[model samples]
Target: MLTFSIFAVLIGLLAINVPVVAAIGLTSVIFFALLGQGSFLAMLPHRMYFGTTGFTLLAIPFFILAGNLMNTGGITRRIFRFAGAMVGHIPGGLGQVNIVASVIFSGMSGSAVADAAGLGQIEHKAMVDDGYDPVVSASLVAASSVIGPVIPPSIPFVLYGAITGVSVARLFMAGFLPGIIMSLGMMAALAVLAKRRNYPCSACRTPAREAWASFRGAFWALMAPVIIIGGIMTGFFTPTEASVAVCIYAAILGFAYRDLKLRDLPGILFASLHQSVSLLFIIAAANFFGWLIIHQKIPDKIIAGLVALGASQAHVLLIMMAVVLLLGCFIEGNAIFLITLPIFMPVAKIFGIDLINFGVVMTLLIMIGNLTPPVGMCLFAVDSYAKVGILPLSREVLPYLAVIFAVTLLIAFVPGIALFLPRLVMGGM
Candidate 1:
């Protein structure tokens, strides 16, 4: 009854458009009060503190700042140049470049919305001027940007590590193969679509010399990911320390290239702080709500119910993936992560599933959510920049979405696709 009441109130608040953080907190308070556990109120402040005070979470803000600095410093353009040299001769030249740029930039930033906001403008404009549909161009950018979180140094993996007690380094390594698969999957989809439409290829097929020259210009930017993942795997630095390294690398590239100015620092700092605070607040509230579930033994009950139903591990994961996909249409990705991870992690462990593989699945699902309607951050970012509406963008994204979903299912069933790199590089997970 108490569990039902809590979920009832949570659903009611969400239906009325209350912010997720506030809804979670208020529902938690109501649940505790109903139980007459007044002392539970005291736990709120501590939970809030612990949620945001982690050393690993410190990487989020630093990485955000570094991404902004890199954007200001002309890193995006250099990466685009390299991508163009490599893939611009393909049908739908600029569209293919968008995918290539996303794969390359995902290695650097690890945030989808940041990728969309940073790269959407140039890619969209180039495609439109080159005779592609604006909506199609915008949709492609939005879809490709989802790659950012699946790559190494991923913000989602860091959050998963913090919440699930999994190894962040292993999760980072685990992400590599799946990320490449997503990139390839999207590229394949784009190729078919481009061929059907007979889209134009680049007039100048960039020679190997030009391609190498473009790569040289972006060499430092390319090395950022290696330094980050390599350092973490080598035990040279923690994730937090890798963030500092990213900042230092971005700073040197910005100043030496004379792209990011001293004046830009304040704005970059403000943006990072704003994003970090919003994310941390949601996490804190979710933690409070998570505590309520623990106090009420909700996860245990749910697990017992599933066991009684004789659901296999695969069946349980299928249900979870369906729920995540449905919720992704309505809620923001980060909010879904904070609210669902705690609920799902316990049940998943009961089936003896590996947490690292689960982390990869969760990251992929949330990223797919970022391309869905109403609250898809990547969708909104690209829409705003390209002046395209959601409905049209959604229609344009359907085939690409189908391709992504197929890859997601493969990753779900084949744990090695997600776990192999991590195990190989980290000497077993």
Candidate 2:
């Protein structure tokens, strides 16, 4: 009853336009006061601190900083040129380039907003100039940005690993194949849309010489992922170290390309700091809210409730996925992850489910949430940067959402879709 009441308050607050961080924080305090445990309020600061202090959490800000650097340093433009040279002749033209560029950017940034704000602007502008419809172009950029987290170097995966004791490296490995599948699926969907809508396409694929030239220009930018993932695979660097290394690498590329300047450093750092603080603040607040949930025995009651209902593992997972998807339409993805993991992780373990498989699926679901409406972060980011209106952007994103949603179900039901690389190299479930 207390758990239900707490959520009721949270939902009510959100419906009234209360900020997520404040809503989560206030709900906890309000509930404690009502329950005559106001004294526990003193521990809120400690819970928030502990929640944000994990070693893995260190990567979050660095990854965000790397993304902002990549954008300001012109890395995203080079990536756009390379992808356009490689795939611009496809039925979708720059639409194809949009997905391809996002796939590459995904490796570096580990952030949907970063992808949407940075590369998304370049892709959106290029497509619009190339005669692609503004709404369709913005929609594609918004949808493709979700791939950032589904691939390696994902912020949500980092948080999930810290919470569950799962290996972040293995989680990174599991994301590879699924991320490729998402790229291919979105490209296929775009192909049909492009052909049906008569969107522009080049006469033929870029000439080998031109492709080579673009690739040469983007060579160093392309290496960001290779170095990060290779270091992880070779055990030469932890994910945190990988993020730092990539930041330095992005800086070098920015200078070598002669696109970044010393004067840009301050703005870039301040921007990165602002974003990092925003994300970390949410993490801190959600931690407090999550602690309240755990303290209330919500996980135990949820497990016992499912057992009493004679729910199978599949049923339990389905119910959880459904809730995540529903809430995703309104809540931010990271907050959803923090809030639900305490409840879902326990239920998952009780049913003998694999945490790696669960984490990948959960991350994918969170990615989908970012593309959803009412509060989908990627949609708003794309719209803000591209000046695409929400109503049309929301409408146009539906087909791609279907594609990603299908892939999410595939990963959920066919665990091997995610676990193959992890099991192959790491040699464990």
Candidate 3:
């Protein structure tokens, strides 16, 4: 009854348009009050503080700052040029560049919305002028943006690690192979679609020397992720330290390249702080909500209930994935992760699942939500940028979705795909 009441209050508040953070806090308060544990409310401040005060959590702000610094420092143009040089001769030339840029930018930003907002601008205009369907272009951009969180330095992984007690470094390593596989899968899907439609290729091949020049120009920008991942895997630094290292690296590169200016620091700092605060509040609220779940012994009850139903671990996992997908259609990714992971991670552990593999799978699944309807941040970001509607964009994203789902299933069944690299680097899980 208490559990039902918690969900009822939460869902009711959500239906009436209350903010997720507020809804979570209010529901938690109600649950405790009803259970005659009103004194639990006194612990709320400590829970909130501890939630955001982790050393690992420090990485979030640094990463956001580094990404914003790179953006203000003109790294995007370099990345675009390098992508153009590499793939501009293909059928659907600019579309291919969009995906390539996403794969590259994903390494640095680890944000789908940032990828969509930054890369979409250049790729969308190019595709439109090149005669590609505007809606399709927008959809492709949105889908490609998923690569951001799948790649290294992913913010989602950071949140997942903090919540699940998994190694953020291992999660970073585990994501690489799956991320590349997903990118290739999307590329192959695009190729098939392009061939079927007879999309136009670039009129001129990039000159060999010019392509080399562009690659050289973008080499430093490309190497940022390598430094971060390599340092972490080599035990040269923790994830938090690596984030600081990246910030310093980004700042140096920006100044040396004369792309980042003194004037930009204030804006970059403010933006990072704003984003960090918003995300931290959600994390804090989630901490209290998660505490209530524990106080209520929800995980044990859930496990017993599932056992009575004769559900296997795999069956439970599949059901959870389906629910996540459905919720992704309505809620933001961070909100979903904060609200659900605390509940699901316990269930996952009962099944002998590796938290690393679960982290990768969960990240990918949430990314799928970003491409779906209603609250798909990537979809809205790309569509708004391209000046297109969500319905048309959704239609155009079907093929991409098919490719994404295939990759997700592969990761689901073949844990090695996500685990192999981490094992190799970390010397076994």
Candidate 4:
């Protein structure tokens, strides 16, 4: 009954539009209050503190700052120019550039919102000016931004590792193929649209000299990921240390390019602070919520119920994936991770599934929610780029959504898509 009540209150709060952090925090508070555990209330602060105290978690803020510095340091323009040079002559023109740039930028920003609001602004406008419809342009940017978290240095992967004790380095390596698959899927969808709508090509072919020039300009921006990932994989730094290392690299590059002034540092720090606080609050509240669910043995009950259905492990995995996908439609991805991972991680163990593989699949599925209707944060973030209503943006994202879903299913069934690199590097998993 307590478990049911906890979920009821949570769902009710979310339905009425309370913030996700508030909804989660309230659910935990209401649970103990109803149970008359006044003594438990005092421990809530401690739980919240411990939840945010993981050393690996420090990467969150540093990565955010690195992304901010790069954005302010004119890295976005360089990467975009490089992508446009490489892919702008494709049938989809600058539309192809938007997807390609997203693939490259994903290695840096690691957050879809960061990519959408940052590089996405440039992509959306360039596409719009190139004769693409505003709605389609915004939709494309929002859809492609999903690749941000699907790739390496993913914020979601960091959170997942911190929560599950999985190796952050391995998760970083795991995202490579799935990210490429998602990129290819979106590009294919864009090509089909280009043909159907007769979108203008931005260029017939970028000159070899021009391509080399853009590549040289964006060389440092491109190398940011190599340094971060390479350091982590090579044992030169832990993931947290890698984050700090990347921030220093970004700062130096920013100064070298004269794109980031000393005055910009404080503004960049504050921007990262704002985003970090918002995410940390959710993390704190989620820990309390996770505690409540575990105390009630909710995961045990859930597993029992699933077993009673007599489903095979594969069937059960699919059912849980579907549940997650539905919840994602309403809840923010981070909140969904906090609420569901505690319950599902154990289930994966019961079914003999690889946790790393499950994490990648789950992250990709949750990312799809970022492109869906009503609560798709990416849609709203990219809206300013198009001047379109959320409804129109959502409608226009359908084909790209299908592409993402297909790639997700592929990764879901074939764990190698996510596990190959990790196993090669870590030598098992």
The local distance difference test score of model 4 is: 0.89
lDDT of 4 by residue, 306-419 (tens): 779887888977987898888878998988999998999888898788889888988998888998867898988998656799998999999999998898888888998799
Ranking by lDDT: 2, 4, 3, 1
Top candidate on TM-score is 2
- Ordered list by TM-score, greatest first: 2, 4, 1, 3
- The residue-level lDDT of candidate 4 at 372 comes to 83
Q: Candidate 2 at 279: error in angstroms?
A: 1.2
How well does candidate 4 match the true structure in TM-score terms?
0.98
Weakest 10 consecutive residues, lDDT, candidate 1? Answer: 1-10
Tens-place lDDT per residue, model 3, 1-429, is 666677778878887889889998999998899889999899999998888988888888888887788777778889989999999888667888889998998888778877888767777888888888888788888989899999998989998988888899999989988999898888888888888987767878999999999999999999998999889888999988888998898899889889899998998899889988988999999899999998798878887888889988789878888978888887789888888887787888887777898899899999999998877889988877798899889889988888888888889878988999887877767
Report residue 68 deviation for candidate 1 (angstroms): 1.1
Model 2 error, position 271 (Å): 0.8
Which portions of model 1 show Cα errors greater than 4 Å?
1-4
Model 2 weakest lDDT span, ten residues long: 383-392
Which stretches in model 3 have alpha-carbon errors above 4 Å?
none
The digit string of per-residue lDDT tens for model 1 on 291-403 reads 78887888888899899999999999999899899888877887777777877989999987788988888889998898888778888999997887988998899887887
Q: Over the stretch 270-363, how does candidate 2's per-residue lDDT look in tens digits?
A: 9999988998898899888888888878999988989999999999989999989988988999888877888899899999778998888888
Clashes of each: 0, 0, 0, 0
Evaluated against the true structure, the overall lDDT of model 2 is: 0.90
TM values, all candidates: 0.97, 0.98, 0.96, 0.98
